[model samples]
Target: MEVQYRSQFPVCSFRLTFAVCVCVRACARAQVCAGAECWSVHSNHTSQPSVCGHDDDAFKYCAYTITYMLLFPIAILSNTGALVVFFWKCWHRSSAFSVVMMNLALSDACFSLTLPLRLAYYFNRGIWYFPDWLCRACVYGFYLNLYTSIFFLTVLSMLRWVAVMQPLRPQVEPVRMARVCVGVWLFVGVASVPFLLNGVTQR
Candidate 1:
């Protein structure tokens, strides 16, 4: 039983990670909790920010602000550098795996670009100065990237296994992997459309 549990650990961890991606893509707000009430102030409105959720929920916002602040720079910068390195490395090579990684890094970089808007929303104390469409886009992009990166990583892992199993197998065509990555982007993009329809609401 112990050995079985140990062997299953990786599967459990993957499931947990996938679950988190689904949840985040559905809501896209780290500060917002399930069934929690939330609202943002319009720039033109002369009203105070509306706080939602329990008293301790304020801590959630604080935590998100700090986390996003720290993550923004690191994710954005690292992913940017990775895209460059991966592109050049994969260039002139039939490394399908590296192509997948380029897409993964690209997805991360795209999402990281949206962090400033999110940070600004939090910085204003929940007052939203951006247009409603922009808000929806940010949330949409967050989830889209979330799922895309997961699928890419999964594909990369499977490819790694194939590489290990048949070390003599010729490298997969980069074009083929690019097609797979495109399919992932399209599938996740279509699935993410529903996220634009909902968000944390105000009282």
Candidate 2:
């Protein structure tokens, strides 16, 4: 009777193990089928190109393309004209106001130069095909110009305020105004280094 009981125990254990293996395989197949179905549905539903997990819809692409196209030429021509006029008429002036205006025009012109790259990026639907270094340089120039413009504009406003309030203060020396412009440019350049480096390093 004991021998018979031991034999039956082995059979029961074997049956239990077989049942678990079968159940696991069945569950795995079901999961595979479900995953395949979900993937098929997702692929079918999404037709637009994606960038960084976000869909680049046609409307968004068109909007940016139109905006960049319109702004690119306008910015380049106007800023170029302004810079030309500033150098032609105001470059020899030594007043703080003139210095600020010159720097502002310079900054705007530099920013405008980067707009063609931006236009190309948007035209390509947000994909950057340019060399990584060029892209970084363009981006750095854009940001540097932006901050420099802001800084110089603020300084210009303050200078105007002082001129209006004092009404009789001696004119700012050309050398001093030149130093201020240099300092502002240096500050902007130093501040932009990290951003430029990070952009270059990123994937």
Candidate 3:
């Protein structure tokens, strides 16, 4: 029985590999039907669905378009409220934690402001009507926001842990925390060079 299974295994593996290869080839040259037009997508290099098509059904791309649409308004409102509250509290009684939270809200709010630009590509149904330079900036900002959020969240976690572990110790000054936030933004911006040098691409 074991020998029989071993003999069939290679055949099963070959069939699976062949199926995947066929799917990849088909997807590489797939032509999407969009109303009165059709376009062939030869390759998709970006994480976003930089695909070929213009249709009312474009937002059918559940991954990016719909997600961005939902994210835009919610992020804007929530972050704005957070920013206002943080600013008011920090103004009256500043602390390292509040300073960090303020910066985080500011970062998210700024990023949310760019959501419209991000959605422009999707709302137009996978087409980039924005200027190439603007496209590159948006792309850079996407990555910058991602890393900045991660870094800020990490800093917040560490600060909380420090507070818990050493409740009696003097809290770090808000001034220094603000400086750290500045340094984080600078480092993230420097690290994420705009893709304009490579030329913004659309499939």
Best by lDDT: 1
Per-residue lDDT over 32-82 for candidate 1, one digit per residue giving the tens place of the 0 to 100 score = 465654556678876555666444445445555766776777776677778
Off by over 4 Å in 2: 1-57, 91-93, 200-203
Clashing residue pairs in candidate 3 are: none
* Candidate 3 Cα deviation (angstroms), residue 133: 0.8
Q: Report the C-alpha lDDT of model 2 over 1-203, residue by residue, as the tens digit.
A: 12111100000111232354455455545554342323323546865543323233554565556655666676667666766665665556545666667777778777767877877887787788888988889989978887887788788777766666765767677669778999999999999997678654443
Q: Report the candidate with higher TM-score, 1 versus 3.
A: 1
C-alpha lDDT of all candidate models, in order: 0.72, 0.65, 0.67
Across 155-179, the per-residue lDDT of candidate 3 in tens digits comes to 9888877767766667799999999
Q: Stretches of candidate 3 above 4 Å error?
A: 1-63, 194-196
TM-score of 3: 0.67
Residue 130, candidate 1: how far off, in angstroms?
1.4
Give the C-alpha lDDT of model 2: 0.65
Model 1 TM-score is 0.69
Q: Is candidate 2 or candidate 3 better by lDDT?
A: 3
lDDT of 3 at 76: 73
| Candidate 3 least-lDDT 10 residues | 5-14
